[model samples]
Structure formats: C-alpha cells, structure tokens
Target: MIDLSSARLSRRGFLILGTVSASALILPPFLTAEATAANRYQPFSSRLSLTINGRQRQLDVDTRTTLLDTLRENLGLTGTKKGCDHGQCGACTVIVDDQRINSCLTLAVMHEGASITTIEGLGTPDALHPLQAAFIKHDGYQCGYCTPGQICSAVAVMKEIKAGVPSHASSSLIDAPTFEPREIRERISGNICRCGAYPNIIDAITEVAEASA
Candidate 1:
C-alpha cells in the first residue's frame, strides 16, 4: 500500500497509459538494424571489366544487381526497356557473348567477364544496322518501346538459324530450316510486340533474313 495523493502519475492514469506510451517515446535499436544489415551486405569491391558496345568498360556494382538494372540505373543505358521485370516480355533483351538473353533475368555479376551488346551498340546515326534500317523502312514499331528487344531478338534469330537451330516451321529433320517468314516468326515469337505490329515486324525480319542469305 503506497500513498497516491502526491504521486507524479495517478494509479488510474498509469494503468490507462500502458507500455505503448513508453514505447512511443523510446524506440529500440532494432528499428534500423535490418537496414544496417543490408548496408553491410555490400558487393565485392573488386573492379569488373567487360566489353560493351565495342568498348571495354570497368565498373563496381552490387553483386545482387541485375544486368538490366545495372545498364539502366547505373550506366544510363535506358534503351533496354523494362516492360516487365520478369523475363516474359523480352523488353530487356541484350546480346551476351553473341547470344540474346533477358538482361533482367541475369545478374550483372554473372556477366563480369562477358561481352555484352545492347541496342545502343547495334546502330548509330551514320549507319544503322540492317535490321534497324529494315524496321524503319517497314514501320515495324508504333510506340517503339519494344524495338530494341525486337531487333536484338531478330539478330540472334538469324545467327541461330544459320547455325542450324531448328524452328517449329523446320520442314526436314536432317536439313536446316529455310529462312522463311514462318520460320522467323516462330523463332522470334518469344518477343511480344504489344503494339500489335506483328505484320510489319515480320516484314522487317524477312527483309533482314533475305539480305543475310
């Protein structure tokens, strides 16, 4: 039994004001502990070198960063669009070691020593790549957001077909598929043109295929 008349806080008032009041006034260190832990999880500080766009580049980036994120956020190479973070859209496609892959699906750390070519490396104002010129001539794109991926995919498709990679339209079991519109469309079907430019896109692909052959 204690005296309550001269107490700083009344018994009833203290009971009404629970531990929440005290917690509101004072926070524990754990509030920011997770952020501190994340900061501590730094990537290897060693410099990484890779050839990009016919030029060698050295960069230091977080190990967890994806190639698409590194290109767009770190290097300011925004031509590789991010239509979908997942690999379904092919908007983030890039040529890695002469192969087209979804940049968004690959970690930058994985391509530390690989050669990478984005749409920026493909064409320039003076001489656009054949595929790029064809796309322009055929009006293959409307919004043009997916143009980079489309071109990269088209380039890789030609190389693959030349290498005898069979498509769904391949007629013979032993012989390589002919460079036909159906073959090109089937091979590049992974790349989705949201603008519904399939006809013009196919036209562009056919033009390049004919020129290549």
Candidate 2:
C-alpha cells in the first residue's frame, strides 16, 4: 500500500537505502562460508633473512606482520618501542641497513638480507656507547620508553649530519649541519619524548657530538 511516487527520498535517505540493499546482496555468500574459511583465514607467510645486532637471523613470518612485531615476537629484540603504530610517533624506530626507520610501518619480508640494530646492540652493563653514557650522565632517561628510539635516532642523525645530509633547519645551513643546536633539533624531531626529557636529551647528544668532534 506504499505510494512509490509519493515517497520523496532525500539524497541521504537514498544512500542509506542503497547501502542496505548492497549489503543484503553481497553479505549472504560472504557470511555463509565455512567459519574456518571466513574467520580463521591465515595470512600468507614468507621466509625472511636478516642480521640483527650483528647476528644473522632467519625467520618465517606472516606477510601482514610488521618489522616491529618480528623483532619483538620472533627474534625477541624488545628494545625498539612501539607507539602510535602507524609510523607517526617514531617510537618503534630502528636502524635498518645503517639508516633509521619506523619499523612498525614496514613488513619484515621486505628487509631480506638487511642489517638491523636495536637498542640492545648499542651497549652493555660494563661498556656503553658514548651517547648512552652521555644520556645517563645528563639524566636523559625519563620513564625510558622513548629513550631507545631517541638514542637510535640520535646515532643515525649524527651519522647523517656527518655524511652531509641536510637537516630540516635550512638549505643554507647544510654545510655545517652538526655544529648548530637547531639543526640537531630539526633532525631528531621525528623521535618524540613523551616524558619531556628533551632538554637533557639534547644536552646528551650535544656532549657526545662535542666529545667526538
């Protein structure tokens, strides 16, 4: 008894009805499949080989797994922190093939034959990297989650500066990248310190840089 001609459906109403109709049309076969096939589908896996902390490693990982998960779950290098897993926070930063990267944004299978360095590789109880010692000396550890990534990024940042890679500070300052505090700040901006230890962190990096220079 509904009057089709009298039904003045607005654009929003039309879209809603269309969506319902499309879902009704498409969802039956998808939902009716065996529960194992539909719900328990396994992601494809690939064999990956990479060097970690100066040790060779081989693992079979699900294609969907990120390098961060591979390090934490499979190879068990847990120093790399995971925050804002979409690559925004830079907490899961690690050095890959001599360059720093957000491990959460990259799949493990993509880095076959690559070299990775985590915070565990940096130092030990007796021996410490200069940056690590500087971090400790300058009181740079606050809550300690971001320190690993911060240190890793700092190590790579200094190397990048030494290699003449321009900092975000300015084009005119490219030649003297390591000498300025602003250049170091701009370079390590991607690594965030939620505990607000930035002043001491900068102090540590500056001391390390000065000592090395």
Candidate 3:
C-alpha cells in the first residue's frame, strides 16, 4: 500500500539515470588507468660508446637526444655551432667515421660505436691543425659562428678530393677531380658563411689542399 506515483519515474528519466549510474561505475578503472599511464615517469636512456676527440668515452643519454646536443650539452664540446638546426646551414658539421655530417641532424644513439671529430678535436688553442691555422691566416670567418663547420667540412673536402671523388664542377667526369677554386667552392658549398667570406674561405681551403698535396 505504498504510493507508487511518488516512486515511479518517467521511462526516459529512468533509462538516463540508469545509464549514467552504470557509466559512473564502469569509468573509474579506465580513467584511473589512463591517469596512471599519463603520470608514469620512465626515463628512456641508452648507453652510447663512441670515440670522441681521440678519446673513448661512454655516455648514458636519453634516446631522443641529438648528436649535436650531446656534444654541446653533455660533453661540453660547444665548438660545433648549432645554426639552422634543419641541417641546411651545415653549422653543426662534424666528422664521423671519416665522413662529415650535420651533427644537428643526427641522433647520438645512431653513432654508438663511431669515431666523432668535433672542432675541438681538430686542434687546440696552441697546437692548431693545418686547416685551423689556414682559416685564421686567411681571415676565413667574420662572426666565427660558422667557422667550426667550415673547418670540419674543409677537412673532409680535402679528403674527398684526395680520394678522387668527383663533383659537378669537375672538368672531367671520368678523370680525378682537380682541387681548383671552383671545385673547392662546389664541394664545400653545403657549408655557408653568412658574412660573405667566400673568397677568404676558398683561399684558406686552397692553402690547406695544396699543403696536403
């Protein structure tokens, strides 16, 4: 003999309330799992063993780090400038396994067992490498931000020429390329100096090339 009218809800209201209650009961675990996953902090790092500057070094770095960042941040090798990190400016150039590459564009993990040579590796303040000396002798740089990459690239360019690698500016495609000004310019074109020091750079590179020859 209870009042059924007071206890009864509209069919739509009943359905909506039941559904909401069911959702509330079922959603906590899912929401909690998602929140836990979001809050989880797992450091992602890798062990890298590489020869840097003629010294064998081991480092534990985050997998997402780039070679340039590792060199600049972890190893304190800031001589390699990071300009136009898109790899277009070639300011982060470094020699890896005898090949010059834009360090900014490469991951440190990829070169785990490779030999890396940065600007600091090429020479010291008192004992300068030939190219380092040549760059200074010819005033090859103005701002000097791009000088490190230029020097590294010039070293590789000389090696490439000596290895008989032909460039587009080479006079004869079948024959070995000559180390002329045009060839040097074309070879090291990837390394740009915004200060319009092309002539001086060319002069420095030519001096080094001739000396190496």
Candidate 4:
C-alpha cells in the first residue's frame, strides 16, 4: 500500500510546476516557429555580380549553390555539362579569370566580380573558336558529353604553353614547357572521355597548337 498521505507536494513545488506549465502554454506560436526556423537549415541568398562570357550578370543565389549550378540552373548556360559532380569528370569545366577550373567543385559565391567563360562563350554556331573548329575537323568527340570541357581545357593548355608554364611532363623545370604529345596528354589527364575519343582530341589540340605557333 502506498503512503498517500505523505505523498503530497508542497505549495511551493505546485507553484513551480504551475509556472512551468503556464510558460509552455503562454509561449506565442510565432516564437516557437521562429525558434524552430532558427534551428533548421535555411537557404541564404547572396547577390552576385560577375562577368560571364563578356556580359555582366547579376543574380541572387543561395550561398550553398555551386558554380556549375549557377551557370546551368540560374544562368541557363547548360553547355557546361555536369558529369560526375564530384569533379572527377571535367564536363563541368569552365574558364574563370583565364584559369580553367572544374565548376562543379567550386561554390558560386566564391567568384564574385570575376570573369567567367563557359563553352557557349567560346564560339557561336556560325563562327567557331579555333579549338572548337579543330574538334569538329578531327572528330574529337563521339558522344560529345565531354567535348566542352575538353575544348576549354585545350584552350587553357595552349595558353599555358605560350606563357612558358612548366608542366610535370616538361624535361627542364626552368625552361618553358613544349607542346609535345606527352605534355598535352599529361596536362589534359584530368578530363575523362567515356567514349574514348582521346586520340582525336589530342589530334585536334595538336593542330590548334601548331597553327597558333
């Protein structure tokens, strides 16, 4: 048998319990909602102004958005393919400030006020860039999923060679890197072509390099 007589709570204890209960009930719903919203992950937007393909573009994008997503989803530049968003495949490659980067690996918010160029920026339907023309002439792409990245990387590779940038394949670190087949292959190793159009790609890049030289 329980001692019901001695189990009674004191007046002070009752008052404390009542106070807690009242607090829980009297709390405004909006306050609770605000607290919940604060704890939850919310998408924050940031204003971005960058030059894309020689045109100034301003957009409000989520801070977490990737550069690839900004170009494809926000800017409607779908030419930069998204293959292996993990940055393994170079389909998401783009040129930023004359440097080639995997757009999928970079956040859009990081490149504010920067100059960016995508595959579409490289050429038009009527007049093609030299690399693009060479790709078509040599059949550098089969499925063409990786063609944009390949062409972009190829353009950078030529620029790097012209600027005397030494690559790993270069024989002399101090001397300028030559546009040898091995050097070209080594430089573009990051780009993966599932259709195995490597030979044609190399040929196209080689043709462009020679013509520019």
Alpha-carbon lDDT, every model: 0.87, 0.88, 0.92, 0.92
Off by over 4 Å in 1: 1-40, 43-46, 168-175
List the candidate numbers ranked by lDDT, top first.
3, 4, 2, 1
lDDT string for model 3 (1-213, tens) is 978689788899889989999999999999999999999988799999999999999999999999999999999999999999999998999999999999999899999899999999998999999999999999999999999999999999999999987676645433556678878888888998899999999999998899789
Clashing residue pairs in candidate 1 (N, C-alpha, C atoms within 3 angstroms): none
lDDT of 3 at 40: 100
| Candidate 1: residue 199 Cα off by (Å) | 0.7
Please, what are the lDDT tens digits per residue for candidate 2 over residues 1-213? 989678999989989999999999998886777654758776798988899999998899999899999999997788898889988878899999889999999999889999999999989879999999999999997899989999999999888877888766766554566646767888889988888988899899988887776
C-alpha positional error of residue 148 in candidate 1 after TM-score superposition, expressed in Å? 0.5
What lDDT score is found at residue 77 in candidate 1? 89
Model 3 TM-score relative to the real fold: 0.80
Q: Pick the candidate with the highest TM-score.
A: 2
Candidate 2: pairs in clash: none
Candidate 3, 108: how far from true, in Å? 0.5
Q: Candidate 4: misplaced stretches above 4 Å?
A: 1-38, 170-175
Model 3 steric clash pairs: none
Whichever of 1 and 3 has more lDDT, that candidate is 3
Off by over 4 Å in 3: 1-41, 168-175
